[model samples]
Target: MTARAPQFCSMAWAGRPVAIEHQWIEAGPSNGPLLVFLHEGLGSVSMWRDFPSRLCERLGWQGLVYSRPGYGQSTPRPLDEPLPPDFLERQALEVLPALLQALGVDGTRRPLWLLGHSDGGSIALIHAAHHTDSVAGLVVLAPHIMVEDVSVASIAQAREAYQTTDLRERLARHHRDPDSAFWGWNDVWLSPAFRDWSIEAMLPALTCPVLAVQGQDDEYGTLQQVFGIAAAAPHTTVEVFASCGHSPHKDQTERLLDLVTTFTGASSPNHANI
Candidate 1:
């Protein structure tokens, strides 16, 4: 049978309705586990290509892929509105739970795993830390635990490329409002105060087993990001792919998938539940 198309939905958060676009694929059995894919800083559901579906198939699990507000076909940000410094926090503390509830994902009844990239990785970390019981396991790729000058410089370069080149046009294909996705992500990273941003403190609270992966040549983050996660959560496993860049799955698809499949499969239910 052909897979079902994604459904568009909206939920109220902080007294405002936020649009969410999501695709769900049921695996072999209704009793099978669930895995959620969280995209990168400027990414949306469309940008993930077939990775989610492939990974779910490999793991024998259902998949949920969604674009957060201000991305993909989701609602656009208001022109005069300025997102709070805690935008990621809002996503973790407010939006995620609401989304889960709307989708009938009972965290207590069934196992849930998060596979997040970049900014989505940070948000997943925060959520797993605070809502310890809800998450079964976490897989993070090129996650930023703290702001770095290297990341800032790369983002600045991206901003310039978007303005003077066809980068905007390319992104437009994925984002419903490309300007919102670009600026919302760009402005925050380039802001001076955002330099001090870090989630190191929250890392210690992540009790579940984590699999953190990073590319050897990732322009936005260094090995330190993975090292920090391992240090904070010693149960965490780390992998670095040679000759890879910011996006490991895109850069080294076969190897990355192999690593993820092995790690997730080896993790015991007790460790995942912790």
Candidate 2:
């Protein structure tokens, strides 16, 4: 089966019901474990292009792909609204669980693996740590365990580029409110307090196998990101690809996909969770 049209999952958040946009890729074994694809900071479901479909089809596993609030066709962020400093934490600790429940994804009833990129990867790590019983394993790409100066600089550059270039217009095609996605991600990363943000403490709590992959030439972060994860989480594996940039799925699709497919299949609960 191929990917189905987008669907919505509604749940209460901040005292109001919120709808998250999601799609199902029904290409694989109906009984196979689920692979949830979490996109990067600036990414939406459409920004992922056909990568999710290709990966799920090849692995023969059902997949769920979604765009968080203020991104893609989901609810747009209000212009005057500001995202909280613990936005990523909230997304992992609260939003994700609510979304899973709204979609009837109970980890106790089925195996669940998360494939997250960039910010999504960090969120996955946090979620895996807090909900070990629900997560089977994780394949995180370019995850940030700690804030870096390079990250701030790159985001600052993006801010400048947005004003001088056509970045906003291009992103508009993907996000309902491009400003919402851009500012929500940029402002938080560049904030002074955000410099001290780190998820290293959460790593030790993750008991499942973690395959942390990052590009050798990633500008947004460094090897420290994945290496830190490996050092913190004993079951973590690190992979740094050369001649690649930040987005491994886009920079090195074939190799990344192969590594993830094999990793997920190998991480049986009997092996990783043990």
Best-performing candidate as measured by lDDT: 2
TM-score of each candidate structure, all chains considered together: 0.96, 0.96
lDDT of 1 by residue, 127-214 (tens): 9999888788899999989998899999999999999999999999999899988898888888876878888999999977899999
Worst 10 residues of 2 by lDDT: 265-274
Candidate 2 stretches with Cα past 4 Å from truth are 269-274
Q: Cα lDDT of model 2 overall?
A: 0.88
Residues 1-274 of candidate 2: C-alpha lDDT, one tens digit per residue: 4899888887887677777899999976655578898889999999999999999887878899999888998887776878887888998999889898899887766778889999999999999999999788899999998999898899999999999999999999999889999999998899887889998988899988999999989999989999999998989989999999999999999998898878876776232323
TM value for model 2 = 0.96
